[model samples]
Target: MSAPRGWRPAELVADRFETASARTLRLRVADWPGHLPGQHIDVRLTAPDGYHAERSYSLAAPFDGEFVEITVQRVTDGEVSGYLVDGLPVGASIEIRGPVGGWFVWDPARPAPAVLVAGGSGIVPIAAMLRARRKAMADSPFRVVYVLRDPGSLFYRDELADEEIFLAYTRAAPPGDPRLPGRLTLEELREHTLPPGPEVTCYVCGPTGFVEATAAQLVSLGHAPGAVRTERFG
Candidate 1:
């Protein structure tokens, strides 16, 4: 693909804490063109000495509005995410390079049943799809299976409660735990995921291994390989 357009300055207009380790930055990009759910932007930060560090993060939902939100998970020694999630100030300015990607986006007009799966911080993009679904108020069914260590670690935990989303805790559990404190099994995945069909579109995002594992399970459950879309990070 060609290089992204000119780096647009996005003012950090708002922010909120999602989890202890993650936070959201709402940027108001000047002259911004609207972006689809599941797209991403490359954020660039510059220091006083003119050295720059950049990282790409998926655009979280509610992006159709004037400002877009991107959630950052602080990584130990991560040059960009660490600063973004823990230190970036509201109203500060950063440059962004894109609203990029096409295939992973959810098209509201198509109106298919959407199966969204996420592992840990990978929930960002999937959250966008959910927001878009809400904004459009379309009748297509939507389901989610979010994998996190515990309830406190889930992104958009409050916003997603009323939706048909399932949380899979891979590590610890909260009160009245359901799965005996373990990783998501094939049974849980099968039970939560909608049966595969042409009218269903499955989107799975997470670390490389999690995406691979989840996509494989979906295919084994009879989802067409082409019907499942995935995005991953290291």
Candidate 2:
């Protein structure tokens, strides 16, 4: 329950474009305290004139004392995201704070089934949870419902795939796909998501509207209200 560590200089050691509009940055911080799956950090960029632009970004990978990874989706007029996604290159130093947030995290050791739902770029944190779950070799099963505008827009598109994840396309389904092109509906949610039960832990992250609807649907499907944890973005 203690506060996360303060801002420290983080050097971008590597970066790659995930999509035309999004990029992932690999930062090497001097003294990272390590982080849990689904936690986030505060990134600050200052202009030469002392103007500050700060934003919160979810950790895109699991914790293991390696370099920290944060995925950024360019916001139309967002100063920080714009810089991170398009301008930041290797060796750039940025001020980063905490591996923050406690309630919305996943602990691999916990004996519970995890139902993860992500919308748009919200997959960043859930991707971390998935990585941790895979690396931990835990027995707990994980099922994911990832909603994206299209296949090309998926972050970590190759790593997280079918068999465990149900990719839902809202704007357009991949060529010849049967799934309709629309936002995730409660019907689709119930069909693709787990059968709600007391032992299942649900984590839904996305834009505000997506988070609200998914959480509500999970509750309506018989899961405990307390078991559904959510984080909203944008």
Give the Cα-based TM-score of candidate 1 against the true structure. 0.95
Model 2, span 149-189: residue lDDT tens: 98789888667753378889989888888888998888888
Pairs that collide in candidate 2 are none
Candidate 1 lDDT score at position 58: 96
The Cα local distance difference test for each model comes to 0.86, 0.87
Lowest summed lDDT across 10 adjacent residues in model 1 is found at 1-10
lDDT (Cα, 0-100) at 72 in candidate 2: 95
Lowest summed lDDT over 10 consecutive residues: which window, candidate 2? 156-165
Native RMSD of candidate 2 (Å) = 1.4
